[model samples]
Target: MSPRQYEDDDAESLPDSRFLLPQLRDADTEDVEKYQRGGLHPVHLGDIYDGRYRVVHKLGAGGFSTVWLARDDTEHRWVALKIVVADYSTSVSTKSQLSCHAASRCASDAVFGFVLERRHFTLDGPNGRYLCLVLPVLGPSASDLSKGIYSRITPSLSRRASYQATRSLADLHAQGLCHGDVTTANILFGLLNIDRYTESDVYRLFGAPETAPLETESGETPGPEAPKYIVKSLNFLSSIESVISQDVRLIDFHQSFLISLPPEQMLGTPAEFLAPEVAVGLKASPASDVWALRCSIFRVRSGEGPFSGFEVTSPVDLLRIVIQTLGEMPSSWGDTLFDYYGQPTKEPTKGSPLEPVVETGRVRLEDRVWKEDKKKPYPPCLSDTIRKPTATKINNSYIDGYSYETDELLEALPKISENEAALLYDLLSKIFVYDAQKRPSAREVLSHPWFHMGEL
Candidate 1:
């Protein structure tokens, strides 16, 4: 059997198989096991798999696998690795007894499926059912940007990020593989090399072992982030930052559907992004990816997604939402969508936070005083609203965070508008047209007005 791949959330996991897999029964046993597991290969800096690939950090965790960043033995490069496990997390002993076997197999199939396609997904290996991907140690994702953690992720940045994602998707469709599932969780935005900052400025692995819960005797978190091991991003260095206008790379292919038809047709993605056809048994086509991509980009621009905070107790219920809203492609889906064309489109008279923040598991930001000197206040580029435990460090602690400082990602804070947002999405919407024949190819997307300054 292969190792289980962790789902970011229950909804991210498929209903048919995920629910069966229970959480780990005990945290204490799991904690002890992390030490006893032996494969970790600990180092003074941290743990490792082999002497060559030093496991400096982790990016995130899942039910069956834990991801990490290891230095390449030969090249001395940073890469991401997904460690396979025997079963679901220790929390679910009461759930699917078959979860372990099924998860392992599915994980293996997923890695192999995408690697063969040259699309983004888990990295593949020859043994232990773990899929370790060597990703470009780029900067933080837009979520990092939006949190006002780094360079403010404004509407323009969000729109541009969406454009890049679509451009990449267009390229993927050209390659005959379809990204079945698309979301902030699945997509990673690379920070252009902003030389103004250094490694100390960004967050390391937020969920890495180095940041293990201090209070938990078992040494693991109550829910996910257990077996903690994913690289965390820092939140400074981007104060004057701009969006990367250069080549933007997309990521996460674990749920990517490869056939000509998008995977949504078979088993759709989380209800939030699922298209109308996908909610039914209809397979998603390039157009399906287009719809989800638009929703994602729009969400980034507005600081919320189409189904940002909605919760559904049953699959049947989610299906209903998918059919009703997705089928309609209502403008309502983009709630906070404001346009900042040269002129600001009229604000929604209804009203909302100027830039509301989501993901409320937040720690407030405070001033940093490194080296025990109050004189060394936090950098001006960094907002006072930074996450607490401020003056974040790569110290041997359990929590790690970093911000993006890549030059490629810096976007000038231009006065952007609803017309522009609509125009941008409408242009990109070509990717979601129900008919694949109607979809614009990558070559075509690049030539569109969004990229071409027709009116500026």
Candidate 2:
């Protein structure tokens, strides 16, 4: 058998297969087919980039980029190297310009931690030129930390993290920048002195890198454009207390844009956090950011967003869920529906006026007197008619096929304290409106009583 083909009995004595192409079962790894043109750039475990940063292990991968844990030989420190796919390499200049401003602002204020680009370079590959960014090594995302049976942090930690996240947004909004995509996954915990960790320490903390060979469907060897094997991303293992105490840094600016000059295309924000206005063909602004912030706050406190349980296959589905949870869409947004669908002429039924139902009265037990005889002792049968409470109609006539009731959507929300729920409802009510212009700014959100319920 070839050296690349290993027998089951000889697995233990085989040499390092990092560079050898070996076929194996599929594991949780990035799509190997993405190594083609305009996709992910193929990289190996020990490959050196720009003659300085040496790739140590994989960090993670997204649709547009792959992040690696590398040691900067020049500085003798560990750093995260994000290699952007050739398709998105054009945005490097825009990101670089924004990073400069962000870095300067962060230097002035040490309290807020924003992941600013330390340095960046270009590398020519088989697919195309790729952009590589050097950044500080950090801990796991808030979403990962808050995931489990409980699905949330302590109330105090949630409050602090929420406040810090709002402050981060306020800072960005103050600079005329809108983080187009704001979600729990982008909120990362800051780590201290991670650069001081040696290779042995890294192995001890994160364990050895797990990898699986890359093989084509036809059982042929993959081209040079693809790596021999795929490396599984490492998960940051740390104590809950440590994660709770650490500061949060807002990372991933690929979707971010200036509020004054919004992007022509729709942002790539997750479906769950997509603002109502944005979902209905509107540009992202600071108000949209506020909408996403409220959703993120909800996720931090509860395990998921209020609308997470509902399936959102399309933008219209998301709009339906939003309307089901938070009343009807504003009349002004009616025209946008036509624009979203590209053609429309059917007239929707006019929504009725919202009116509160009042209860007449409750029957008192004392009001009914019962008499019993000496031989036949039995309570009198009450024949009063039992009335069912009138269900409140949610005026969602804006969407043609919207059939969900208000109570149905509200019932799926994550459970929390009555007080917290009330505060959150008040906050969401103000921000979840269809009119993005009416939403409060992130700075204004910091002053809300929900942020300062009792203590920090």
Candidate 3:
């Protein structure tokens, strides 16, 4: 069965143990009951894998696998050991082959380093056989770094990071491969010479693993299949400054596929980054990847995504936001109609003012005319009026769509200069088009002036 189908099948076969298992207070840890057969293999600190790798700390976990920071005794280096759940263990060879192909294609260049699978092995456990892939240790993801007070990085740094990320996608596309899922979470910062640090140094730098004991509501000790304690993922790297300066590594190719052979269904992509075409049940392509890349760039520069704030229960909800934000969908989509009024009259064509327009003079709050018809939310164009009192007037002619909470949410983003913001807006507009064919290629995105405006 395909991975997509396998997910459905697994869900159907697995018993719902919500009432059986004890409620875990730490939301960061993985589900404790997922320690049975065909689920997560129980792994703990100091556990030896394949007689070579020694698990030291937990990196993170996902729906299908768990990543651990391990020390390779034979190679004497730090490596990320990604252990795939037994249910999907059969596909490890295919995943490994794809990684090798990508690595070989970009072997000559070190700038756009594709994720390479260093080595892989199989292990027997109470949960069943597990496929373990060893890879180079990477730092925090772009999404993790771009949060809290450090939401927005320096413009130069943002430019440099965006250029490298687009270049990596260009290389992959040139090789006829598409990173089906291209979100900020998949782009990680590369740690320089990570193996040089001793185990003690690693603990001191990233802090020791934070763990809590697992328990059963029935007051019985958990079986051997379950881990004794749950280890919290070390989401952020301690060296913030160093992390921002390092180059980026595009990781996670599980959803990736060759352009010649597209999957029937695309799985694992974040709802906010799903492209219009893909969200409408169309097959993923290089063009779709470019669309997702544009969204990722927007989020990297600003704290939040373009289509955020709405509770996205499914891809259709996200598609609605896309139509609401970017205007109506193309006729080619066929019957995917959504009612939206007061859309911007001017499309994001060349020389158009797509960025938020702010007026020159300030208007006092009391003197300003508030729309008495409170039933209809104010248009996005007028959002700046409330945020910046000085910039009072907004040309409603350019307004797009009825009131959007996303605009207000965007107002809370870390401030960037007017010039830089305009440049970035222009770049996003060029790629955020509804037609996939009209969107710029990954290579063309590299040549965009936004990436060249700053020192990067």
Question: Which pairs clash in model 3?
Answer: 343-401, 344-400, 362-390
Q: Per-prediction RMSD in angstroms?
A: 14.8, 17.8, 12.2
Name the regions of candidate 1 deviating beyond 4 angstroms.
1-45, 62-64, 84-129, 147-152, 192-210, 213-247, 260-268, 312-319, 322-418, 421-448, 451-456
**Whole-model lDDT, model 3:** 0.69
> Using Cα atoms with residue i matched to residue i, what is each candidate's TM-score against the true structure?
0.52, 0.75, 0.77
Model 2, 188: alpha-carbon shift in Å? Answer: 0.6
Q: Is candidate 2 or candidate 3 better by TM-score?
A: 3
How many pairs of residues collide in each model?
A: 70, 0, 3
> lDDT by residue for model 1 over 303-329, one digit each (tens)?
446555345322333433443443533
Candidate number with the higher lDDT (1 or 3): 3
1 versus 2: better lDDT goes to: 2
- Order of the predicted models by lDDT, top scorer first: 3, 2, 1
> What lDDT does model 1 reach?
0.42
In candidate 2, what are the lDDT values of residues 32-91, reduced to their tens digit? 556878878999999999999999988888888889999999999999999988888988
Writing each residue's lDDT as its tens digit, candidate 3 over 244-358 gives 2357878888788888998886455887788878766677899999988888888777655686445554565676677667887777664432212111122322111122223
Q: Hey, what RMSD does candidate 3 come out at?
A: 12.2
